[model samples]
Every structure is written in structure tokens, then in C-alpha cells.
Target chain A: MRSHRDFARGFRESLAGGPAPQNATAQDPAEIERRFDVYRNNVAHGLTQALARHFPAIERLLGADCFRGLARAYIAEHPPRTPVLTEWGGAFPAYLADEPSLQSLSYLPDVARIEWARSRAYHAADSEPIAPERLQETATRAGTDLCLDLHPSVQVLQLLTPAGSIWASQQPGGPAPPRAKEWRPETLLIARRGISHVITSVVRSSTGRFVSALRAGDTVARARDRAGADFDLNAALLLLVENALIVGAGIETGDES
Target chain B: MTLPRKAGLGFKPEHFPAITETKPDLGFFEIHAENYMGAGGMPHAMLERLRADYALSVHGVGLSIGGPDPLDRDHLARLKLLCDRYDPESFSEHLAWASHGGVWMHDLLPLPYTAETLSLICDHVDEVQEHLGRRMLLENPATYVLFDDSDIPETEFLTEISQRTGCGLLLDVNNVFVSCVNHRQDPRAYLEAFPLNRVGEIHLAGHEEEELPSGPLLIDSHGREVAEPVWALYAEIVSKTGPLPSLIEWDNDVPDFATLMAEAKRASMILSGDHHALTS
Candidate 1:
């Protein structure tokens, strides 16, 4: 039987470029490292490629060498448990937050956070965005509590790190990603706009109203009071509707009204 | 207008756009099925474009076919979804390995070819076939170590698995070189023992060798061009195996798209070398 200790030790060694298990035969110790190097190289490069696939923006932000260095460190800190690598690196954003080397680029964690959302949105459930008929029925329910069900692929990321703009400027056809200080910490609304994932900077004026209304299924009027600002109800509804992220909605007749 | 069957290249993300842009005439393309399992995204969209233009193969690296634990249901379901989506020309995975006992290793781990392991692998292969609703070709594994108590040779074990499961075999020539050198066995013996009739695909990869004080061990790194010895073995296998659907696999340190196609072209010439002379 393969002991847990032996497996763990071998795994660590494999990650660290050390000797693999001498389980096969009493061969030279150097032989273990020599042979193990292939697996080692594979593990590192495979994960690196997977990471790059997951976060193409990050790969572009930090050139290949820097990305490789970041990837190597991330691998050392969080080795992958599943062979299904597309979903690996779930903890990388958190890992980025604590990485001292990234402290200089203080908003790097938020960038990673946004990148991870892109990964999740890319693979999230495939559901029809809110159909027009459903939205009409919900709005027409007489004397009932209105509710809005967000699209499964929708994510509302609240970061104080100015990442939404960073994500945008980095888009393939968009202008080159703006430099630091060109933008400030802000909120973002990301949704799978068809097959493409789109990130938009949540205008400072509307961020508060959108988050509360979207999450709590609040009445449009009630949501306005909560934010206490001139929220553009027309533009707000258009944002959700035009993007086709409004998947499900309902109205409760027997509420505490 | 179409890709040949002699030898193909494994397509990675970096080469996706270029391959489409260049429209090179080569053999089919192979991709890991699991990578394209998402509902609909870049991999599938691009793959659709490629599929429209080329013969395709969907090779899997994570089925965990010989482990002590139950096979992963979710992974299998997703793989099935991919198979249904792509309806690939050929599909294949590794032999002599099991990654998951409970948690998956992700990397292919070794199994001793004992009766217990053989039964276990057959069970897993059966499950894979039942779930995918189609037979998958099994590739031989590259190894770093060998167990003393292994009762059967890896090829014989693979042959038995193929015979029992009715699955095809994917003969990876580089793995033959790596395992033979690491275990100090004759590569030719392995080729001789392999059930050539069952072979449905061929794989060529580069391996790195490091000499030890005891003996040198060749690692199936797949990070370089096909080694000379491995190329020689590929020639032998192709001549015997008779123009199988071969792939040149360079998964790491992937060079520009042209480099991969160049290597695939080399394998194509070798496979169809009745008229072409060996490179001097």
C-alpha cells in the first residue's frame, strides 16, 4: 500500500525538484532527481499553461518571465489537487493578496480577483438569460412584491482596486491597458454577454443602487430610497435587459404589503 | 482542403489562431477532451472552426482508469459531453496508470500489473466505455520507476486490457523509449510484445535523458523535439503498424505553430517513406 507519508513526501519532492521515491530499487539518489525532473518540468509547465489560459489578462500584464515567476511561486504555495486543471487556481487571488512581491502592485489582487471571475463565468452554468415574456409577467403582477433573478453567469464584483477599468482597457480591441493612477478603485458588473464575458465599470453614481437592488430583489422605488440618489431607472433596467442577464423573475402577491 | 492521416500535431492554445490563419495542410489535430467540456466557449468555438477544416481526435489525460477507488463520475460525465459534442475521429488515453484513489493525482501515476490491478483497470475501462458510450484507445505510459512485484510486462498488460475491453490502442513511441531506458529493457522487445493489431493511433514526443552513476534514465519530458532514438522507433512502429493516425506531442515549452507542423511533417514522411529516403 502507498503510505500517505510517502505519497506526500514524493509529491513535495516532485514539486521542489528533489529526489522521487526510491521505491523502485536501491538506485543512486541522483538517478531519482534526474528521472523525476521530467515529471517536475511537466507539472510546472502544465500548471503555468493552465494559469495562463485561466487569466490571459494577467499573462499580458506581466510578461512571460514575470508570469512564469508568479506561476512558479503560486504552484509552490498551492499545488493542484485535481487533474482537471481548467478549474485549478481557485485560491490564487487570495495567494496574490498575501504575496509580498505583489505588494508594490497593490491592486494586483483585485486584478486576479477579476480574472478568476472571468474563469468562473467562462464555465458557469449555461442558462437562458431572462426572456422578455418572463420579465413582462413579473412587472405586471398586480399588487405583488417584485423580484429579479440574476443570470447564472452574472457576477457583481465589488473591489476598491480599480480593476474593472484595467480589465476593460486590456480587452483585445480596446486601447492598451491604461497606466496606474489613470483610474481609481471602483466597482464592476461582469456578465456573460453571449459567448463573450464583458466587464463594465459601474459608474460611481449607480454602483450603490445596482448592488442593493440586484441582490435583495428590492422594489425599484425602495431601492432608490436605499441609495438616496438620482438613480437612472431607465438606464439601469436597460443595462440588465440589453445584456440579457435577467434570467428569472417573479412577484409575490401575499407579502407584508 | 483536408488534413492527412499519416501524422498530426497536438494543438495548444498559443497555436489556435495561427493554425486557423495559416491553414496548413497536415494530419488531424488532437486535444484533451476535458479541456473543451465547458458549455460553449473559446475552446469549443475555435474547435468547431478546426473541426470543420480538419480531422480531429480528442485524447483524455484524466480518466484515472486503474485506481483503487471508484472512477470520477463528474469528470466522466463532462468527458461524455465533450465526446458527444465533438464526435472526434479517434479518442485515446494512457495505460499503466491510475491517478485517483480518492483525490486525483492529475498526473498519471503508476500501477503494478498484478491481477488485482488488471481487474481494477478493466472495471474502470468498462465504466468509461459505458459512460462515453464509445470505445477509447489506450496509450502506454512513460515511467520513472518500476515495481519489483509486477507480474506482467506493461505491453502485455495493455494488450490484455485492449482485448478484454474492445478498446483500441494508442502506441506512444516516445513512451516506449522512456520506459525501456528507465527500466533497462530493450525498446524493440516492447514493440514486439505490443498488440499491433489493436493499435489505433501513434504518438511521438521528445524525451530528456540524464545519466546517473548507476544508469541513465530517459524522462518522457515532451518539452523538446523527438529524440533520434525515439524517431528511429517511430519509423519501426509505423512500418509495422502501417500508417496509423500519429501525433507529435509537444505540450510544454511549446514552440511556434510552424515548429510543431515541421515535426509532424517529419513523421508524415517517415510513415509514407516508401518513396522518400531517410534523412542523411
Candidate 2:
């Protein structure tokens, strides 16, 4: 019997178009090659389909052929580390950022970041959103000690390019994204709308910072101060409440929980 | 709970709304266990709704039950979490391995049928049954290649695993046809040797054929309607097994809910047909 170690190595090598392992069969060499090609094609094709599903905007922007090529390269270098494909593409945005071929499309990586965040938000834990009335009651009671806990699905992306707009444009009903005349930074907030949908919107940089500070365990007063005068704390709070992005409210006794 | 002796379809999220609205008559809905292993959100919500309407079979594709390395404990833990949450009527995994050297290939790769692997697979099955606290049905693989070192016949190998680990079998008729044709063997003969008494569920799916100098090679691509020959094989099995909770698996290029239900309806017809024939 062939040792599993030997079979694993040979099969892995054969998937990359190497010679079929000797122990695989005693059939004609041509039959072996063709049969083994199915396994090779299955791996490449299956993983590529998974990537396309997770990052449809990337596939659309790059076109089908270009996306397949890119996906092949990424699969070759970073095959899924786990069986859960939802967790498999976390490194893809970084992979795109480091790719020399895609350097011309500088915003592609940031757009990919937004796509990944949307996927994450779609699968994030369910939480009951704190209602505006409850939030106000808590604020009145806790006063300056009030702290906010963002929903588990809420994610803020502070991007170097207007990727929030780019990702949104590629969505099913979104407008065609503008062709960039100049590179500018963009901030986006991602959160689940109920359990069945995810919402992505471009937001002011100050609002992004405000959410970030609150996510980092800052009190409502402190996070609002960090957002500077330009940040409308009320508006940000309203957005969070309306989007069901606030999961909890507590009093911070100078100790981060 | 056991899956009803009727027809079911692989649960696709795109059809969630349609399924919920119409509440199609299905025996059970089978979901890939790995798809719901995430922390939460829409997948769970959709599944929760469907679970109320139908029995569920949590089929796992990522357990790597036949891999050379030790079974992934974290993956098992995740499966446990899902099974505990859903308490599915049935749980199943493939006889093939999908991961090696920490890299998951996302496809079920074949393994040599030998004493070495037989023992390895039995141990893994035992561990899974012990961990999940229930018997898991092991589905046979659809392979395009054979191994020179395989001393045990695939049927005997599966039977031995079941005997050793006390696990039931998931007889995928399409797989039997695909492997038998790809290997130039007879599908009926393979089914004859299969342990039908221990089979808890049955699977029927579509396959694509590629011309080869030797003959036509059948690829188990679950992307279309169930083919006639595969349906014939399924009918033969149903005749023998008496309508054991069959499922129509159309994973890729999934048609709309009506098309999927059409496939399941055909299976239901055959199941009822066989029951009538037997009783008469």
C-alpha cells in the first residue's frame, strides 16, 4: 500500500500539473492523466467559484476572465486554511494589495476590503439593537459615564480610496461608481439590517472615528470628544440606532469591560 | 428523529424565500454543515425558519474523515455546535478526504482502499460519533481514478467501517453510478454489494460525461437535473431500500425552487411507485 504521506505529496504535486503518482493506478498513462485532471480541475474550479461567490464585485470589476486568472493565482498561493470557506478569504484583500499586477488599480484592494467586511457582517452574531428610547433613558441615567457597545456585525472601514462608493455601486441596485479623477480617502460603515440583509454606506470620517473609539471601549462622552467638533454625536448615535448597530449600553466606571 | 421516507432537496439560501412562502412538501432539507458554522446571521435565521417546516439532514463536507492527519478537533467542535443548535434528524459526511497538510482543497479527493486507510477511517468515524453523540451516515465517494494498492473492495471497506464504528451509510446512487462507470464496472453489482440495511438515507444527483478513448468518464457534477441512468439506479435502490429518506442534490447552477421541487417530485413518485409495487 502507498503511504498516505507519499500519496499526499504526489497528489499535491500532480494538482499543479506534475506527473501522476505511480501508485495511483496501473492503467494506461493517458487514462491516468485524464482522470487525474478531473481532481485538478475540481480543486481549481471549486475554490475559484467560492471566491467569486464571496467577492462578486471584484469579479465584476476585473471581468470574468481576469477574475479567474486572479483567483487562480490567489488559490495557488493561499489555498483555504479551513473547511469553512466563509473564513477562508480574509487574506484575499491583503493578497490583492501585495500583487504587482494589480498595482495599477490601487483602489481594488480597498474595495475588496469592503467586500470582505460585508461578508463578515452578513455572518456576524445576532444581537438585539438598543432602541433610541432606551438609549436616551440610559443616557439620562448614566450621564457622562455612559458607554456604548456596537452590534457584533458593525464594522468601520477607513479606506485610502473611495472604496465604499465603489463597492456600493457594484451592488444589485446601486448606481454606477464614478471613475476616479483623483484618489481620496473614504470611510464606510457596515452593519446587518435584521438577520437577512447587510447595509453598507459611506460616512463622514469623523463618524468613522467616533465608531472606532466607541468600539475600542471609550465612553460615549470620550468617543464624542475624540470625534472632534465636526462630529455630530447625535447624528452618529441616530445612525447607529436606526441601523440597529447598537447592541448594548452600560456605565463605564473608569474600567474597560 | 428520522428523516421521513419521502423526497428532499439540498437547501440553497437563494430559495429560502420561495421555500418559506410556499412551504414545499419535502421529506427533509439537507444543508452542508460547514456552511452554517459561522457565528450567526442570515444563514442561521433562514435555516431556523426552514427547520420548523421540515426535517433536516446536516451533511458535512469538510470533516476530512479519511485524511492521513488526525481529525481536526476545532472542526469537530464547530459541527457539534451546529448539531446541538439544530438537532438535525440525520448527519452525514463523505468517505473521501478534502484537506492535507493544513490546506483544505474544498474537493473530495479519493483514497486508496487498504487496511491502513480502513483502520484510519474507522477511528475517525468512531471519534466523530463519540464527539457528536450520534451515529453519522458515511457517503461513498465518486472517484475518477483507482489505486494499485487497494486490497479491499470499496463495499467491503465501507461495511467494515460501519461494523467497526456502528455508523449508518448514506448511499448516494449517483456516486455509485459515477464511480462504477468511471472505473468501467457495473453499477448494479456495486449496489448489490452495498449494505442497504444499514443505509439511513439516499442521495441522487446529476453528473456530466466527458468522452475518453477508454469510454465516457462521468464527473459527479451536481449542477443539473438528475440524468435518466442515475434515476434508474436510484429506482433500483429504492426498490430494495423501500423509500429511505431520499434527497435530490443539485448544488451547482441550482435551478429555481420550482425546478428543484420538480426533481424532488420525481423521486417521490418513484418512492411511492416502489411502495405500491412492493405492497401489491
The digit string of per-residue lDDT tens for model 2 on A185-244 reads 999998897786788888899999999999998988888888876788879988988888
What is the per-residue lDDT of model 1 for residues A169-217, given as tens digits with 9 covering 90 to 100?
A: 6777866655766766676676676665554545554644565566677
- Each prediction's whole-model lDDT (CA): 0.74, 0.89
Docking class of 1: acceptable
Query: What are the runs in model 2 whose C-alpha is more than 4 Å off?
Result: A179-183, A255-257, B274-280
DockQ, candidate 2, vs. native dimer: 0.78
The best candidate in terms of lDDT = 2
Q: Mind giving the per-residue lDDT tens digits that candidate 2 earns over B65-167?
A: 9889889999999999999999999999999998888999999999898888999999999999999999999999999999888889999999999999999
For residues B64-159, could you state the per-residue lDDT of candidate 1 as single tens digits?
Answer: 676565677887888878878777887788774435334443567665677777877888888898888888888889887665547787988998
Weakest lDDT window of 10 consecutive positions for candidate 2 chain B? B271-280
